[model samples]
Target: MTTLNLPVVVSARTKWIQLFLGLVCMASISSPQYVWTLLTRPLAEKMGVGLAELQVTFSLLIILQTFFSPFQGKLIDRFGPRRLIAIGTLLSGLSWVLASQVTNLTGLYLAYGCLGGLGTGIVYVGVVGLMVRWFPQQRGLAAGAVAAGYGMGAILTTFPVANSLAAYGLEHTLWLFGAIFSLVGLLASQGLKAPLDEVTEPASRFVAQSSRQYRSGEMLRQPLFWLMFAMMAMMSTSGLMVTSQMAIFARDFGIADVVVFGMAALPLALTLDRFTNGLTRPLFGFISDRYGREKTMFIAFALEGCAMTLWLMSRDNAVLFVLLSGVVFFGWGEIFSLFPSTLTDTFGSRHATANYGWLYMSQGIGSILGGPLAALMYQYTGGWHLVFGCAIALDFITAGLALWVLQPWRRRFMQQQA
Candidate 1:
């Protein structure tokens, strides 16, 4: 098979620079999904929609972002990151800009849900695939760092966005930030490209167990891939349920306006959650690098499960709520890093982007089950306990799967492939 070799030299320094560029691009596009919670109440009020109705936008964003990734991944492989990401950056920013002017649910859905989802999907899948190839020896770390940009990027904007929504109104804040994100993301995209063919060598810790490069179709035939997909869907559902609905629940619980460390608890929790979420990717990725991916998954996934339970038990205590929310994110955000790195390790980097795209679609399934469905559950139940209960159950199941099912299954599959 002939690899498409990069024309220019990519030194270690250059690779790091490429990763940084991807990081910045990912960070710039993060708020549309991550900060959706902050915008939920405002958008609902403005459009005269219910919480479950406003959440459709959130679900659409994840659905488009994850479901279309295989096509986006193929585009990245064909056209390269620079051009594709540029288009994505433009669309992402444009989504918010159009959203700022929307007067109804349909307009908001088109702007934030469809366009924003497509754009972020391109940037996300492209950057992750790029990282796996770029840092063959440190795939986990590379994936984690870029994923951290997405996971934690909202930290830089949370307070400012909350303040802007208060002082400048949602429309002005959306327009201003949208313009800035578009500019920054485009600039960052210019620095991205596929790694040199030579750098695509496999360097996973369990290198002796590696299989031949699998195309997207070949990958889909593997039972292991489906297992991972199921596990991803479960974890994604649990995490996204909290992520998309945190602010609403906090408000309903009467803790949203409570002061925590001189800032409103909701934004404060969000800021802290972003930090821990970002921190966990690299930290757990590094751990997975040495200790193994499934082990790390079991630990972190279980941590989230426990954190969610504790957070609910202590819902009335504002301070505990804020702290535990951070823990929950810390445990959950590593999924972005772990899943891609593991998929690339199992299937090989030849089709890393496209292969992971299929696995990533699990998030779309998860968004439906977790985002809108969870919201709907709350609407009917008139309480969040059912939603939290479902998430908690899935978390423990995924944690167990990571250890018992995923680990042994991967070992056996790779041994057979070898």
Candidate 2:
């Protein structure tokens, strides 16, 4: 493999500044997914649609966001991050602006689902790909920090969005925040630039990483990549089920309207979940940096399973329900950090953006199973018990895969590269 000998050096301060800008950009686009739950009830009432039908929008958003990532990542890789990300932020904000005026389901899907998905997808894969290259020595920490922005950004918006929905009505609220998201994201994206190959740090010895770069096509042919994809799919299903269905299930559990800790249970739980979800990415990523990726995956996945079990058992108690939701998210959100970091470690950073983009399509598969499909399951089963049970099972199964399958396979793969 040939290496570049670029003359321009990216200073340490410049790299950190890039990371900060990436985080801000990620945060700016987060509400389209994380804040969707707050809009569901109103959207449903306005459109006169069933929950299952409404959730297809969520599925579409995720499907488009993930399914097209390879193409989007390639564009970012070739054209650089600034212009594409700026355009992405604009489209994301415009989705909401357009969604505010839509009268029917198809229009809603096009505006909020297609446009929002495409826009956020660009920013997400672009920022993550940038982080892995810029911080090869701290892939976990850097990726997690930016991923945390996506997860936790909602913390800053959840309550305000909830309040806006209550005060201004859904349409006006969408317009207001949509404009804000666009402007903020556009400004943040202006500062983002890919690191020059010569300035990037080599992989740290503390973590296992491939010595040679593998193109996306080569990565796709590897059984190891497929195994990781399956694990990520299962984990994504478990987490996204909660993400897209939490409000519905909370209501079914009779806790959505219940006041706990002097606040409405649902919004409070959502707020707390955002915080933990955001915190866990960097926290677990940092751990994986030293202890190993597979080990951290086992621990976090198992924690989510345990938390889900407890959450199901204690559903009737509003206080426990709120607290447990946070725990569940804490265990689930680190996938964004761990998987990308692990993939770069295994595949090499030269093709990191496009390779990880291919891997990210797993989230789209998860969204199909977790979003509309899970909603339909609830409709058929007439309760959330079976739905929650299935998610718990997937959680444990994925946890097992992390230790028994991924750990060994990844070790061998790295040894061969060595």
Candidate 3:
């Protein structure tokens, strides 16, 4: 009997596959979180809904994460990241076209919230999990590289998106975005595939306990689980705060152009952060593997929290001077890989995919909370000062929490930790 093969190759060409995966994640994240404001007003005006009501479209997409992410994780594990990514990219295109055809909030929710949201979740899990496996020793750098691609998507597409808005109008612009997203994403997502070794039989409470398999659920019972989770979430929340409000905050702080703020923030932040954050992943992961996950996490988190607090307090002036992002980019760049490194170190190698899935979820959670929280403060209190103050407070509290939990978690998981 003859059997068909996948025609896949592992070569120099395969690097593009990883690059595509990064872009797919970039485009997926950019649409729902970063670019919403650009679309929100026009869509609201077109649909005759209030801004907040239109904003519900954003809320629903995020809210759906609770439902979609797990299933996406399942699909990613089953079919490999490449197939799911292609399908998701196509679906995302269709969602845009459907959204452009809609005239009401319900339609918007159905297209953007239901379809596009889930598609993104699927593509994200498979691509990201694949990236980790591809660069096993370089997880943090890999994570940052992929994440920075995501960060740059909005900027890369900004021109086409704007040009479409001018030429096509609101409804047609959605259609244009849909088509463009699919093409670019499809091109980028080309090389995404899970390693053959990733398949596993479902098991409980067993930690995969080694690099051979990493199970986050099993790790949850370990003390290091909560510590790393909290550490990542805290640092993520601060970055999301910066992500969520930098443009508006820049304008409020006397910058003439909010657009410039939007354009500059991600590149500047990601440029430095991705390198440091990525390099830290393996370094810290190796450290935790040798010493302990908890100690490394405690140190990493402490430095991150301190940097975040100091940056936040200095933000008004530096940010007011348009140098605030530089300050933030410096302090806030270390957490991405360290967070996962901590998790992988504590849980052992078996659970990297599952645990990292959970780790990635923190950014999603932070994205949801950070954006509106900053906006709400501005709405209620009438200033960006409160937003800055609140961010500072959160970072300080996060530092204390990191210091308190990590050492103890380390002590308990000392032997099994990476």
Candidate 4:
């Protein structure tokens, strides 16, 4: 039997260029999510709100970014990545710009939370979708690379933004960086275009992928898809807790302001977390490509559980706190790579963008659980220990699900498809 394939209309080099452009677009919009912690304190003070209340802004950002991604992904699939991503970057930047001028909490929510969420959501889903299509055989690595852009993109701004927040104040910093983010992302997105055709490669000897394409609605109905969604939601909660609450917990641990290796512990840890977080995506993705998605997920998720346990234990030590923060993120950030790749492998690429969008909404569910709800839990409990403990439990549980449940289920699913 012969396989019917879409003709390869673009050169191999063209896809690489497309990947690079997607990465750049991703990087340009990274600051909103990754650098959000740095703005939390100032924003809280400015709006005269409590930590739990201010965290609603973060929740809104994540909720809109993820909850609405299905629509955004569909738009990208219909209109192409270039225009939508360009608009998204501009909206993302404009969120900060408008946020800087706002005087009330509601305005902040609308500007920074809603607009920013919608914008970043578009670019994120669009880029990941584009990368998976462009590099079907190498989906894990490609998705990881662009996801790394989102995770690590703030590395370039973490220190600079910190210094700016200190030197120029929140208004000027937000305005300047907002403009920069918009211009850079817009320029980068101009070069992005989805692959017009598929180029099939020899099937991997290790990993099994679906030969038939499933549309978004059909994929959504599968028990296997819901299982992946539940798994992703747990992982997202574990990771987003660290991401959104690290600063608060660091301060509570009495290490936020402590100097560790010359820099403040909080910023230092944040910077290192960015690096490890960004590094883990492509690293684990590369491994997943050769080994298997569930195996890589198990290893990485277990590592995160161990790292979080260590991090909680070392909370009192500034040096260890800074170091272990990176380890914690290293374990958590690979979800972006593994989930989308696995989704595409199971569902096929015809509707990969929209299908992944449905899966990505799990992150929104996670953001709610991990962001404001975790903060509320901390408020109710009077400490972060309970919050951290719950997150640790989730990490191990999801890891177990991946290895024990998902692996076998996916194997059988692919077999039935065959």
- Model 4 root-mean-square deviation: 2.2
Q: On residues 1-418, what C-alpha lDDT tens digit does candidate 3 reach at each position?
A: 9977643434545554665566555555455544555576578678886544565676566545434665676666766666777877777667788998988889999998778776666665555566655554445455545654544456555555656776878887888778777777777667665655533322212122243344655665655566566656666667666555554555465542333445544333433333343344445544544554445556654555555556555544533334444445434544554565445545544445556666666666665666566566677888766666656566666656655766554545554444
Point to the candidate with the largest lDDT. Answer: 2
Global lDDT scores for all candidate models: 0.90, 0.93, 0.58, 0.92
lDDT of 4 by residue, 1-418 (tens): 9988756555678889998898899999999999999999998888788998888899999999999999999998999888999999999999999999998889999999999999999999999998988887788999999999999999999999999999999999999999999999999999888766555555556678788999998998899999999999999998887779989888889989999898999989999999999999999998999999999999999999999999888789999999989999999999999999999999998789889999999999999999988898888999988888999999999999999999999999999999
Q: Name the weakest run of 10 consecutive residues (lDDT summed) in model 4.
A: 196-205
Model 4: colliding residue pairs = none
TM-score of each: 0.96, 0.97, 0.74, 0.97
Total backbone collisions for each predicted model:
0, 0, 17, 0
Q: Against the hidden true structure, what lDDT does model 4 obtain?
A: 0.92
Give the Å shift of residue 47 in candidate 3: 3.8
Best-to-worst TM-score order: 2, 4, 1, 3
- Worst 10-residue lDDT window, candidate 1: 200-209
> Which parts of model 4 are misplaced by more than 4 Å?
1-6, 198-200
| Residue 279 miss distance in model 2 (angstroms) | 0.3
How would you encode candidate 2's per-residue C-alpha lDDT over 1-418 as one tens digit per residue?
9987655656789989999999999999999999999899999999999988899899999999999999999999999999999999999999999999999999999999999999999999999999999988889999999999999998999989989999999999999999999999999999999887667565687888888899999999999999999999999999888778999889989999999999999999999999999999999999999999999999999999999999999999999999999999999999999999999999999989899899999999999999988898888989888888899999999999999989998999889877
The C-alpha stretches of model 2 lying farther than 4 A from their native spots are: 1-10
Clashes of 1: 0
RMSD values, in order shown: 2.7, 2.3, 6.4, 2.2
Return the clash pairs for model 2, or none.
none
What is candidate 1's TM-score against the reference? 0.96
For model 2, what is the error of residue 393's alpha carbon versus the real structure, in angstroms, after optimal superposition? 0.8
